[model samples]
Target: MWRAGLPGGLRAVFEGSPLSSGGSPRLLEGKVALVTAGTDGIGLGVAEALGVAGAQVFLSSRRAHNVQRAVETLRGRGLQVSGVTCHVGRAEDREKMVQAALDTFGAIDILVSNAAVNPHFGPILEADESTWDKVFRVNVTAAAMLVRLVVPHMEKRGGGAIVLMSSIAGYQPMRGLGPYGVSKAALLGLVGALSPELRRSRVRVNGVAPGLVRSRFSAALWEDEAVREQALKELGADRLGAPAEVAQAVLFLVSPLASFVAGQTLVVAGGAWSRL
Candidate 1:
C-alpha cells in the first residue's frame, strides 16, 4: 500500500492472501497490533515502533515478498511479529488478516489502517469515475470496514486503540494529487465521525497526518532538486519528514501517552502548513 505506480497490473494486492511469520513494546507488552500496508515506509516504521513498545505486531502487504521481508526484518529485531499478504481493499483478505492476527496473538488491542491508493494525479474534476472509486475504495472505505471488523474484538478486550493514517495533502490538498488528498480528507472526517461512538466501547480512535516523507512511495514528490529546494523552504533545510518521525506520532496515539486523546488527527508535517 505504500508503494508507487498504482492501478492495474503492477502488484496484485487484492487476491486471497497467504499468511506468513515471526515477531514488541515494553506500552504494548501484552497488546496485539494489526497494520495494513505495513511492509515498508511509514507503515513498517509504525509496526516496528509498536512492537518495540511491547506489542505483538501483525503486518500485511499486498505482495507476499513484501510480507516475508517485513516479517524477517522485524523478527531480526527480536519483536513478536507475524505477517500476511493482504489487499486491504478486498473484504476476504481483510478478514483473513484480522483472523491471522487473532489466531496468532490471542486478541487484538491496536489497529492501524494505512492502505491507500492514488491512481490519478490531476485536477479532481478531470479524474475519471474509476479513478475516484479506486481512490476511495482503498483509502477511505477499507479503513472504515476495518474499524467494523476490529472494534468488536477491541470491545471484548475492554478497550483498544485505532489509528487511521491521513496526510498533509488531506488538509492542504496537493496540486495534482487531488483524488488522494480528498480520500485522506475523508479519513480525517472518519476520525471525527467514529470517535464518540468508539469511546462507548472504551476504544479511542485517532489519526496521524504526515507531511511529505522520504520513502520510495513518495520519491516522486521531492526527489528532484528544484522540488526538493522548494520543499525545504517550506519544511526547513533539515529535509523532508522521515517515516519514523511519523511513526512516533502514531506510537503516541496508540499508547497510554494519549489516553485522553481521540477523534483528533495529529499532524506530523514538520513545518508544512497543514490544517483543515
Candidate 2:
C-alpha cells in the first residue's frame, strides 16, 4: 500500500536538492534529454531530476519568458540546462524545439513529453470541438510528433528512452475534466502502440500517471478545501503529491535503471485506485 501524510515542509525535498547541496548522482552522466512544458510544475521537477542525474537537459514552454526563467532557475542550481519557447500545439514550434535540442546537445538520449492542456473542465458532453482539439493537440498529437522527430536521433545513438506524462484521471476519469481525462487516456494507448515499433530501433517508450500533485497546474484540485477533502477521501491520500516525487519516476524511466521496462505506465498516485 502507498503511504501518505508527508509533512508540509518536506514538499520539495528530494534525493539531491539545491545543486550545491551536493550528493548529485551520475545515473545519466552522458545523456541528452528534452522535456516539453518544462518551465514549471512537473516539467520543471522532471528537468531538475534529469539535470541532477547528470543529463544535459533542453526544456521548453509556450512563453519565451517562461522558458527563460526556467533555464535561469535550473542554471542557478548548477545543472546543465537550456530552454526554448515551444507551444507544443504548433507543429512548427515542435520542430523548432527538436532542432534546438540537437543544436545544443548534438544528440538526444531521452525525451519526456510532459506538455498538456485542459481548456475546458466541464462535462464531456458539453465540450466543443475546439476544446477537444486543443486538449488532444497538446496532450497527444504533439507528443507523438515530438517522439517521431526525436527517434531518428535516438536511433543514431543506438538506443534511448521516452516518457509520456499521463494522469490517474486517464485510468479513472475525473469528475469534470472529461476532455482532459480522455486525452490523457490516449497517451496510455500511444505508449503501448509505439513501444514495440520503437523498440526495434532501441527506443524504449513508457508513460507516467501522476495523481493529484501540488502545483499550479493542479491548484484547482489541491487548493480548494472541498476538492481537497474529496480527493483525500476518494484517493485515500494523506497529502497532495510533490512534483519531485513524479520526477523521480521520470528519472528512473529515462535512466539505465529501467532499461528493460517499456510499454508500461507507472502510477505515482499515492495508492489511488488506478487500473485500466
Candidate 3:
C-alpha cells in the first residue's frame, strides 16, 4: 500500500511483498520507533522509511495540525503510524510524547532525535544569549533528556538503537549559521558520551550529519538559486540531497544493519569537505 515511487524512489523498498525485489528485508519488523519533529521534511521521510521497514512508528511535532496531517499521510500509505503534538523543548510535552508511544506500541526499539531549531543566522559572536539558550535547549538539552526518558523503556525491551540528527555544518561550520553548526557539533560529542553509559543496557547511540538537504525547514539554503548552486559546487554534488536520502542513512543506523556501528557520526555530505 505504500505509494508508487515514494519521494526517495523507495517504491521497490516499500511496495508489494515485504521482501519485494530490491526492497528492504523487513529489518525493523515487530519493532516500534519514535521520531521527534516528524511531521515534515527529514523527520517525515525518516518516519516513512521506518514504517516501510515494518516498524510501528510514533511521530511527534510541535503543532497539532502538522501531527494530524503527517499521521493521515503515512496512514494513507498503509503504514502503522501514530502521532502527537510535542514541543520538545518543554519537559511536559516530552513526557507526553514518550507516554503516548508506550501507550500505543508497548515498547520502544528505536529513537530518532530529529527535532532542532536555528532561529539566528549570523556571526556566532553577533548572536544573543537568549538565542543561544534556545538553540542549545532545543537542539541539545532536549535531545539528551529524551534519551534519558526512553533508555529505561528500551532496556526493558532488551536493547535498542538511537540516532541523533546532526549536520555537515557540525564538522565544517557554515557561514551565517555558526550557532546552529555549534549545536549540531555538540551532538557529535554527545554520541560518544552517551554510548558508553548506554552500552551496558544494550543501547547503541549514533549520529547522522546530512549536508544541504532539500526541505522546507532548509529552504533558505536551497531555495535561493545562487546559494544552492554555490553550495552544490562546494559539496561537489550535482544536485541537492533529498530529505529521503538523509532518511535512508538514518534507517541504516537504527536497524540491525548498523548493529556494530556506534558512537560515530555518519556524514552524508555528498563529498563535502566535512572532516573535523
lDDT of each: 0.84, 0.87, 0.88
lDDT of 3: 0.88
**How are the candidates ranked when ordered by lDDT, highest leading?**
3, 2, 1
Best by TM-score: 2
Clash count in backbone of candidate 3? 0
* Candidate 3 or 2, higher TM-score: 2
Per lDDT, the best of the predicted structures is: 3
Q: Rank the candidates by TM-score, best first.
A: 2, 3, 1
Clashing pairs in 3: none
Better of 1 and 3 by TM-score: 3
Model 3 misses residue 79 by how many Å? 0.5
lDDT of 1: 0.84
**Candidate 2 total steric clashes:** 0
TM-score on alpha carbons, each prediction: 0.88, 0.93, 0.92
RMSD of each: 8.5, 3.4, 2.7
Clash number by candidate, in order: 15, 0, 0
Per-residue alpha-carbon lDDT of candidate 3 for residues 64-135, written as tens digits (9 for 90 to 100):
999999999899878899999999999999999999999999999999999999999878899999999999
